[model samples]
Target: MVIYFTNQTGNTTDASVSSFTSIPVLDYTQALSPTTKPKFLAQLRDALINVGFLYLQNPPVSVATQDALTQKGFELFRQPLEKKLEIEMVNSPHFLGYSRLGAEITALKSDHREQFDFATELPAPGPDEPLYRNICGPNQWPDETAIPGFRQATEEYLSEVDALSASFTALIAESLDLPPTAMDGVFDEPQQHKLKLIKYPLPPSDQTSDGAGFQGVGAHKDSGFLTFLLQATPHRGLEVQNKAGEWVSAPPLPNTFVVNIGRALEALTGGVCTATTHRVSLRQEYFIDADGKPLGPRYSFPVFQGVSMDLSAENITLVVPDHIRDLVKDDKVKSDAEATFNKMFKTSIGEGTLVARVTSHQDVGQRWYPDILAKALQGQKDFVSKQ
Candidate 1:
């Protein structure tokens, strides 16, 4: 019933929200040299504090890299349905791989009319962590004969992206006032993270059905720390919700990665950097352009940069005020936060499910820490001599 993509009624611009307003573009281009580093950092710090997202231009990657990846991507997406399905998303445990149209459940009431996913190539882990034996595993892809140069281009694009993401992580740490060592122990030793190359293709006009992309993608907040989106050159549909609960068009900016802070940042900061809601806006088929003809579908590519899931959320105890903590203790605030987070990943919270995550709609917070830390310390001390 609720239209999530483009808000039904409200202001639609960068200043949509009262708290998380759109920030000025931070020109980090001068970060290349040692002398201008301070100036670059100042701009970055201001942007992060005011808005969790930024438009990154002149990033580490070159223009040639973008063009190459975009070309190879088109080839892969245009492959026959059977070939595309060879390494389908349904088969990937972590939801990594090529997906078909209507594969997303964005609206809750209906599936979105588009498909996108991620890929990662981490190295094999040593015995220190067996759970991640497959963290640096192979990416399953359709045979190259069907889509020539697909494998090579994709791998190259992924490598460049990985390096770029790491660079941004270090810079973000600097912005947060933490020593660069702050990133230690958080990422998997082998450094594996989810990286997607999205493609929102054109939709059909004559007929509409389960596959029509009108509801192309669902509305949701990002789940990780930061997302670096290399937008489609001709993109138009991306939208972000502002503080006032209104939707504003975030059309792709050329030569800029639409960067956004995600839930991990919010958790680490104890809610300082709010996880903003965003989704791809699907223009109806009947919607006409200024030319008096129906407009075609738009495209966008988002790469969600992240650390290992096994790591604990960052401790932002110092950032939040005592009053917010009190608000977090209230029944409504606690329940709502937990439920909202649970729904983001489609996990459960109620009783009787296999995992307690779904069932415990109640808030879990620092208030429970005193009692928990007391028992934990006793257990540690009691076990010290047994060894």
Candidate 2:
């Protein structure tokens, strides 16, 4: 059941809140069935083309498993500050591990949430491998003694989401009127998947000054193919930007996940599906703790599934159907699609994501990846500076 309130997107103008329309909801069970597939595909296409966001009901992950993971997430966060810091992200060149509060910068501002990121548990790349391959290394796990079942629950949950995301990608291909397996190349073996365990610390006050208050997380768009977010608590904050530039709040619903397209999909489709921008905001009630206080942290688990990092442009197949390609008549979009295609073919999705990380989280880049950070800055200058 998707509960959409009559809340106007943030931009609605009225003495009383204007009624905003609800985002579309897709029934995952029907979507995967032969009998209901055509209808499901039609709705899926409509949802992606129109809103680029939707509520996925009856996901592959069970409610009980989700609850177990949520409890584990809370347990991990509840560890003593010293214990939590043992696997700090700054220590990992691959950008795995925990990020303390105020460490992640977004939209040129500090995000008020701390998070732990885990990716495919692979071995560290050899020294001779491409620097970007460094991101493919093993994740930094918390001490099982300190947080028993944390690793087991997280790994299990990630595996479930990973399988579901792969299945959904094939459905996306079907919805686009392509061969059901047309999107398979993106998820070739060794594809990188990330699960983020995030906790948004409650704001001291409503003030938006000195970076001391709630910028729970600044506005941004996901950079991967598809993102599935599981909200453990009912604390409201997540909002999605609509076509009219209004921000609509997406509150938590039982057995539903708020899914959104990411930048890679937008590039791959030549703008047919958008990479919608969204952000998090905090309300006083949800701010259960005072500044420097910890009442109960708001937790969110977002799983990002993207193409194989090693995939190059030459090996990548852009899946925009001819009809969709014909619809992309805008010269700029065409150019961007071409450029992105060429860049990815030559480098890889792994490189693109790495560049994005360094650009957004400069401190992380500077500390753990200074060499790559310098190269990125040089590339930026060459691209934008007067010739």
Candidate 3:
């Protein structure tokens, strides 16, 4: 699939798979300035339609704030194993808490990373409420005495990123040649966004080079609208798959966030905007120092901008222009069979999200929602059998 973009010289150029190497870097501040806004949007449009991933520079969050958040993540990971287990995700019905290494599954395989997940604090749903509403609830935070100021730093970062995501969503609407607020109605009041602090530890020396245990996180498309990832380390583990099924490296850039379109956005845009496949492959080199000593683990913080849980097929109203819709590629890479079940306009967003959560964290599901877990597993098997 070749995507054409107008370059600075006003000349059209094709971004073919062979020519697509690195992720495009777009300055967020440029999108704010009147003179540069047009150029930024053009680049953003191309990035979204073609690569589905880009490095965002000069984002709303300050360097100090990002550094503090990164520091807090490191501190949180350094805590005793017992402390982390105390707030294990298995204990949370909402799936908001710490997850030890290999606790989460992706692509039906264990992801070789430990993570802490949290979202906007909200009260649990009432007994008579729909089952999908169980996804909304307060987060399980670590002990403040053990990690002082960690909560403050994380919340501050989330607040700043929330504003940035909302602003970016508007820009995305404009980029699609729609009204700036065209997609605003899809977001719920007090939007429920999720953030994760992940640490991809070094694989065993013997397994690093082999294909045995290198998956930090298996290839998959994010289920939300957008994902703003802070690659808090100087390692090359993240890889984005192009339309041609080739993996392109997305290395870390200072003061930048690697932003990617998600499935919800793709569905909202009628496939005009893509949700690219990406994964993190663990390698010994990525965690070794120049002196050959281990440099600990690779850390990353990714925040997923959430949409309304009630959003369903009936709620979709935005229509992509004919010219823009023509840009949709026919040869786009397909996601895993299990993931394809989450397509928007087929079921309510909350329903799909709940199934995915229950499938991924079955321990939590078994304890809090055994029935849902069994149904989700059966659903996956049924879907896969048909495919």
Candidate 4:
């Protein structure tokens, strides 16, 4: 192994000791305190340096709240296409809203279901920071009519994870062998971050007819510092390919987020970490009854934490590889987040990208989508009552 000081990615750990096919159970609050900080940072550094996936459990948010969010999301998704269409993602141009399959695409392929995407509170950067000057803005919330607590819940989740991000980033600064508050100035204003609730519905087995991929979110590593993900396990959907090119399951855990560092983080650390490849394929389970049988739904919420576009999470030292140390800007560098995020959603300049491309009818979703879903559920209850 070419262990370069600049190359902080060091060596990939023995998966035999840390590999995860089953769910990982961990409590962030306990794992993140100052006393355990050293050990936790070492483990975290190792995980990012090798496994690239950390399963978490017992996050600050309760199971009930998360379940409620999921329940409300599915109910809203089932509402009349007309009612849900009222608040379209296209309305904001930043691309926040509900999107059906074909609305989101990754790796140049379209995804197979609907989802909601929103970043946490964004701060305006200085005039010199070109990236944030335009790209940073408050989230575009759906009108309360769609779902009374939708915006509030979404915002709350963001806050919870945002705090987690702050905690983790501080630890990372320490793991870099710097002072406790080393990263304070680095991520001064709330770090540029986002929170998402993605529900991958059971696609019709016959969905080959559609251009979308048979999988939910495709195999793609996050492009930022770190991602904390919570998923439903036993359902068997998430997969991460190892350095050996082997595919493994990312099963659900009780409460943790499946965390991983992105390429940018690797770049920041000067390759001291691993940003392993991951992907979701069309399930090949043999349908015993017949074709077109639907499987169960799969849900995941991945909260991404990042530094300002101008702040590089990576600041390699001379002890590291020259290439690694070079990642830090000797002179001011620009952040790629603005263009990258804009392109991901294909929205107007500075408007964050929606998950998928906009067709003629789908215009607004955030204006009041959450309320629409609630109303849809009410109608369902009413229908059942009448029956």
- Give stretches of model 2 more than 4 Å off: 1-5, 9-21, 209-213, 285-295, 324-346, 375-387
Model 1 lDDT tens row, 1-387? 001122334433332134433434555566767887777665565455445566776777777877777777766667778777777765543344665665544433333444435466644445585332332455667687776776676667667777877777777666666565555544555555555555555544543454323545666777666787777555466666665555556655557677888765555545544566776755553244556675444545667665454543232223434443343323432344444444433421111111111111111111222343355446556786686
Number of the predicted model whose TM-score against the real structure is largest: 3
What is candidate 3's lDDT per residue for 60-123, written digit by digit as tens?
9999989999999999999999999999998888999998899899998889999999887789
Positional deviation of residue 385's Cα in model 1 after best superposition, in angstroms? 50
For model 2, what is the error of residue 316's alpha carbon versus the real structure, in angstroms, after optimal superposition?
2.2
* Per-candidate clash tally: 11, 3, 0, 37
Using lDDT as the measure, which candidate wins?
3
After superposition, which runs of candidate 4 have C-alpha atoms over 4 Å from their true positions?
1-38, 122-134, 186-188, 206-213, 232-234, 282-295, 312-387
Instruction: Give one digit per residue, the lDDT tens place, for model 2 in 134-191.
Output: 8778999999998888888888888889888878888888888888788787664766
lDDT of each: 0.54, 0.76, 0.82, 0.54
Compute the lDDT for candidate 4.
Answer: 0.54
User: Lowest lDDT 10-mer window, candidate 2?
Assistant: 11-20
Taking all chains together, each candidate's TM-score versus the true structure is 0.69, 0.86, 0.91, 0.67
Question: Comparing candidate 2 with candidate 3, which one achieves the higher TM-score?
Answer: 3
Candidate 3 global lDDT = 0.82
Error of 2 at 138 (Å): 0.6
